[model samples]
Target chain A: RAHSNPFSDHQLEYPEKPADMDWSKLYPYYYDENTKEMTKKVTITDIGCGFGGLLIDLSPEFPNDLILGMEIRVQVTNYVEDRIIALRTNNVETKGYQNINVLRGNAMKFLPNFFEKGQLSKMFFCFPDPHFKQRKHKARIITNTLLSEYAYVLKEGGIIYTITDVEDLHIWMAKHLEEHPLFERLDETWESNDKCVQIMRHATEEGKKVERKKGDKFVACFKRLPTPEII
Target chain B: MSLIHPIQDIVSSEDGSLIFGIIKNEVVVFRVEEGKSQLVGKWVDELDRNEVIREKVEKEQARQIAENITKKRKTNDESAKTIESENKTAKIPTPGLGAPTVYSHLRNVTLSHGEKLLIICADSDKSVIIFDIDNDNKENVLQLKKRQPYPKRPNAIAISDDDKLIVIADKFGDVYTMSVDSDVKKIDGNVEPVLGHVSMLTSIVVVKDSENKKYIITADRDEHIKVTHYPQTYIVKHWLFGHNEFISSLSVPQWNKTNDLLLSAGGDRYLYLWNWGKNELLSKFNYEKLIDKYITDAHLASERFQNEENNLREYCVSKIVSLPSNRLVAFFVEATPLLIILKYSPEDNTLKLFQTMEFAFNIITMNVNNNQLLITLDNHESQNKDFIKILDFNENTDRFSTNESLSNNLDTTIASTLIEDKTSHIGSTGIYPLYTTINLKKHGESYS
Candidate 1:
């Protein structure tokens, strides 16, 4: 139903800026008295994190780093929240998987509001809405306008990861990321060795669906280029 | 079953006979007579009792259940008969308006006057509820005395010790004060900005000076604390400045043995004690010193993630309560599992960090009554497992500890030494039926 509406309102509710956002409620575990501030930034974010299989797998691997999943669907977000709460409760003694959280947010519109400039280290767009029609391309997760917002939040040497079974969406994401002056394409070796890429390729429900269908997965990786130094 | 909302604020009567807690949509009063806690009275919004809305909501839910039953019946013949019978007899209690529609942000203040207890709570929906819990009656009953709506949503509320005046702080960085008997008036052109901050005000505290002059102390997100003359809010007494981050909590503790002091803690890792009357900084306690020794059981996502960067993890001081004999107990969220006790010496103007007590769960709110420390845990998991733990302070050890013997006794719901209530029970008397079958049928007709 959401994908069929090409002209649906894109505006979303967001905080004015990162300072106005209460990060403590989102990542309570990272708050400490010594620093007197939110110590951990959400270094990695998965846009349209459907079913959150990728986040569930990646949370333990990067136990120190904060990971966030942003999903637009309300029920999907609720499911993720319950899942995380269950995981946290079951592992309270060991304090396992306390680093990941999910929020119901329109990542395409509110990316800048949630993240400070140069705040993010990695961003993922896995099996996002293809929005195949030329007129509906703007609804696709990756776009030229959204890439600039992504670049503003991503730190220098940060990575933007994209993978999809649909070649159209993969090409759309790669073209937008490559066309943006602030990003550079990463070679195949970087994609092969990166632990995150491996998980993204196999962990998500979409990845599993593609595997069941015997479809090919197109993966693209891009690095956020540092700004040029002035003389 | 009643809808379970997390306890936001906890307040105890001065005589320690009663405790009032503001849950999501209602204020629950627990009577503590002879060391037994019992749910006596509750205050909920008027909208929660609108029968027309309740009928509509219930009908809709029942219709959906019926549809699901029919669909399942068609698929599985054996299971269909049991499902149909359950649907026919099982009544879906319409907890529509009974449960808070919007997650509410509530700040509560309680006052004791003779035999009556006055509790004021400000909700994010711009409604201020004043409830009177009268103990003079046979059973303590809670009555909604006043419900006032304002243009701006109030975030913090304070009642005078004498129970004469009520002051409310709103999200727009403004404070309004009026007699408890009178209604809150709208902000007009003639009204002067007496108690206000440039940023969102986090806390408002009322304290009477040595000369009996009433004063209001307010703290804001921008780290500014202002002391103003009460009633005549335009008269600025002093601005306490020095906090580098948002001031989340402000406490004015008066000890019979020592001078009255203002304690403020927030995003800045330091807890600053001030003499609000003189607007002078008395002492600052650096929390960084206690991190290594006290915070051993920190639940962080990553072991590699350092606790502090340059020196700020954005830890906030959520609660602070003062005890007798110049002692204090502070609950710091994101800082440690241990509650820090501090001692202040007026003569030397030195603040000594005393004992740190550990709790099993992450504490959300705490209140001190006599020698009992009542604490509410952050309930992010099972709502039915909420417990209010009571810990006794020992003078000999100079430390606070819970009775391990009583913690094992968990039969009662709300009265046990460790009070546990099923907050998520929808069929409980606390819920309001916000829906009905006829209304649901009408709603279904409109949609189809």
Candidate 2:
């Protein structure tokens, strides 16, 4: 299945996974019990994953899970590919350099196209670009319209994790999630219990950057509510 | 067997030993160990619902009668003399008379300095109130004025360094500006044009250049840092683009011996340092670099290796600030609150991170004065109240330590340093004291 791609643009540019490529070694923190087995069978997609850090980080955590990072930038995708090779982690993979990938696409638009209803178990928007101004509000990654798409892709009780340093953005994200009928804010107990917070803080590239600056990081988790039972 | 607990409205004391408040308008207390509730004290006749409603109706009738009498009195001088006495008996719920309602859920705050006054932007009432902080009677000086309300909830506010203008940025991306001293009477002259941006303006800093020119440095949701110069106000002088996410906060160090440095933090978890004076980019660092440096260089060889891999690494930079001794501190939110202390060696264009400190929580805002470093943490853990930790830095020995608790939980996620006292404080001075006066009215409940 990896080789029959004559018409596909998804060919690896650098045929050789570089000697320095060692994804398993780079993100050993992700290689815990919970992730190791899940990765084997689960299909993970990272949305707006800049440089595929989360995917790279998760690869080790869930080494068997087929993880994919979707980014809009061709250069960023290439960089992640190089990073993946340098890290030399198997099972972690990438799609072609399309404008939209399972992870990198304008999720608001292509999410429903690629993912069937309740197809994804977890979706991560780590440090997504927040378009702040009133005029630019439409350009924000999370909106009333986009939340519906998230609802469509996410499975019942699926979770979405967001981390941002901007206080305003944090509140904005929370407001939207709280208002969304399909989602509910993760309870304090759940947030503390989940290993994703640790993964987000230490595994993803952005999480580490936040640690370096001592910048206040705002993290919000939302669970996709199960569809209401019919009367 | 399935056990179902009834949904109960239970209000407990801070210590959780005694139950407080009335249950269904009746004085009642709950016995926790017994898992039962019981009526406590008898309700006073005046406090009873029927008597209270009757009193309210009587007050309303009396107010109406007084209003009628006053109207008739105004029409005739003879009647006015009689109605003056009657009007004095009517007690109305006049505005700004009793204790002002307090708003508890304060999400964000901003300080705008005018010619002589400081304007406080708070989210609770969705109003901009002015305060004379320097006045002897600072407590009672906060006067709420009605300017144009924000189109949406405001997220941040910035006053030009000169203290002449104020800018309010909302969650929906509207930037409203008004003069600091503008009141109800001067509102027309105070209102300014809205500055349009591509995304919501998360944070703003009003900086002055070496030429004494003012520039509005704004970070927007679109991950763009805009340097808009004043006087012209037409063209954006330059746009700093690096972060692929939302810019959360902007910090401009006070005029230092070397030059003024502008630091920006964003959702991308990166801190960027820009020299606004030179209109040039300075340094960008992220958590990836920090962890990589630590994990790979546990033997201390990572620095030498990082020097080689610097060109290849993608780093997230969250915040930057100027330290006391011509150095800059960048804060990253990745692992711990890592403070990367950088010293500028003019010999090389690079800013070196000489020392680093680990903090407990993600730092949202930091203020450095003298040798004191005041850091505000983003309240990620709901269990912990948002707080500002003060750290004192010694340039001679190159050590940093906490001084005192400056302020705690001024806002929901982050706290800003409003005033810092530089004379006595070893690090930052004039820390903005938290104002806890706003009283929010309860619905048919006691004000307390």
Candidate 3:
């Protein structure tokens, strides 16, 4: 489906709080039963990661940090889940593809429910739903109110990466981040130096589709600023 | 059995001189002087569904009479008939959940702190109506002032500290702020929402920080509580993440001198206390032991879950009201007859169960007057005509006892006195969904 209502058709399960979340179920390699705790938490996230291309590509690049891809559609989430299982099964001897996983969730509504304050180091928005209608503008993934929530889960100096083929949506996403007080737009020099930005431009299934058509892919990045103290 | 409607909500003026009770679509007023009560004013919602239907019927009859008088003019009659029919079909129900239901009535009511303005949400037209309350004027106590309509029906409303800004959070997960005294903006254009949630917003309250900066604290049906900056609403604050189920109520107690302690509760068995300014869940106060018996069939989930292997039972924390000078906080569960009171321990910053009062019937709604509690009960089928109860906290005994004389006197007011009318029983689903909170529990399988 091209469009899914985030408000309805939602059967996602989340922890009461981040402390109660059982990350071992998602990343069994990191959980140690003797110590009864996971070695590390998920620090990188791919929001609306349609397919497992980005997760598969980032697994080897950042083997130490855990990466999670959150998708809302049922069939797409299932496809990503099966793809991860196959990748991990084929690389069992080397213990590869053990740091990446996919989960079904409406992240716009339940992001904070799964991640604690300042728990994430990076967030990605690659080829998200445009929701081009003026009336459906609030449904877009990037808004002033939702930016506040995204700021809550992201650590200070963390980076937010966005890429879209639709120029109008690119402008809309960039304008909202620029208007927010806690985020500053990263310049082209910083984007060129960043390795994740290079991997992101070609990893997603949507990016491949756009490349086949020889379409333009607009990219923008932002860095989260620290909260100011009250007088 | 004879049926009657119960009082759905209650509010009072700053002083204890006046009290208001909402029954169906009408707001009945009472004058509280000395220890006696007297009926003073009454205002019915103008946009009531039944009233609108009645007016349409009268208009159609008038049009028919006019057509009969002008039967010779076929062209004029045809044009007038077409216009009337068009008007009649204009209000056909929209096939969306956002559309107003048949049980359109006043849902939430409050009195502005500084100004004597009575603000209320009217569901019939998805508008907020404000009235100027003047006690000196004998002719009219509640005078009509302004009616501001929104794109969606408002679910919660909170006025800023300065009394200049009115924030309305609607059922469609959007929040809008408008000037308190401003008139008709609908003709100009639709006002965009300041911020929004993708879930049904249940309650909202405006609270200030240490430096006296105002922020809006909003909760939704998705078990989320969020705090956002006021003027720069786009600059999102951290979310208070704790509640396991839909959060139906949020209250920042006045006793918290610093104004940082926020109490929230919903379908969960525990009431959560949060230091909202710092984004910390302080503690969870369990009330299931006290309210376990109160959960009956009324607290069960919707009928769609009847065939499931296990029945899901839940209750919504309907109302939370704290006192002005004391540390006593009172709250009750929806469709339950128990009113559980808590005394905030300042030393530990925790809420301990102080006392529980069991009434003969379920409490419909309650409001704080000075330090007194004005409660209206669900008294539709019983022979007792006294539906209102007044209780005062006795400092010596550390318990709340009902005042017999005042309770009987208040019963004489219009809220308890019945006028003859033909409406369905209180048990009927026409006026209110008192127990709809249980439906907030998501029932379908994961990833459906």
Candidate maximizing lDDT: 3
Query: DockQ of candidates 1 onward, in order?
Result: 0.01, 0.01, 0.34
B265-328: candidate 3 lDDT, tens digit per residue: 9878888888998988888888888988888877666666664754566677787888765788
By TM-score, how accurate is candidate 2?
0.40
Find the candidate with the highest TM-score and give its number.
3
List candidate 1 segments past 4 Å from native.
Answer: A1-231, B1-6, B46-101, B113-115, B136-140, B183-193, B256-260, B292-313, B334-336, B379-386, B404-411, B415-448
Interface RMSD (Å), every candidate: 19.7, 24.6, 3.0
> Each prediction's TM-score against the native?
0.50, 0.40, 0.85
Stretches > 4 Å off in candidate 3: A1-3, A28-37, A92-95, A187-195, A229-231, B1-4, B48-101, B186-192, B307-312, B347-349, B415-431, B445-447
Model 3 residue pairs with clashes:
A148-B236
- Candidate 1 residue B117 C-alpha distance from true site, Å: 3.2
Q: In terms of DockQ, which candidate is strongest?
A: 3
| lDDT value, candidate 1, whole model | 0.66
Query: How accurate locally is residue B62 in candidate 3, as Cα lDDT from 0 to 100?
Result: 69
RMSD of each: 19.6, 24.8, 7.5
lDDT (tens digit, per residue) of candidate 3 on A192-219 = 9998888888989999999999999999
Task: Please rank every candidate by DockQ, starting with the best.
Answer: 3, 1, 2
State which candidate, 2 or 3, has the greater DockQ: 3
lDDT for each candidate structure? 0.66, 0.51, 0.81
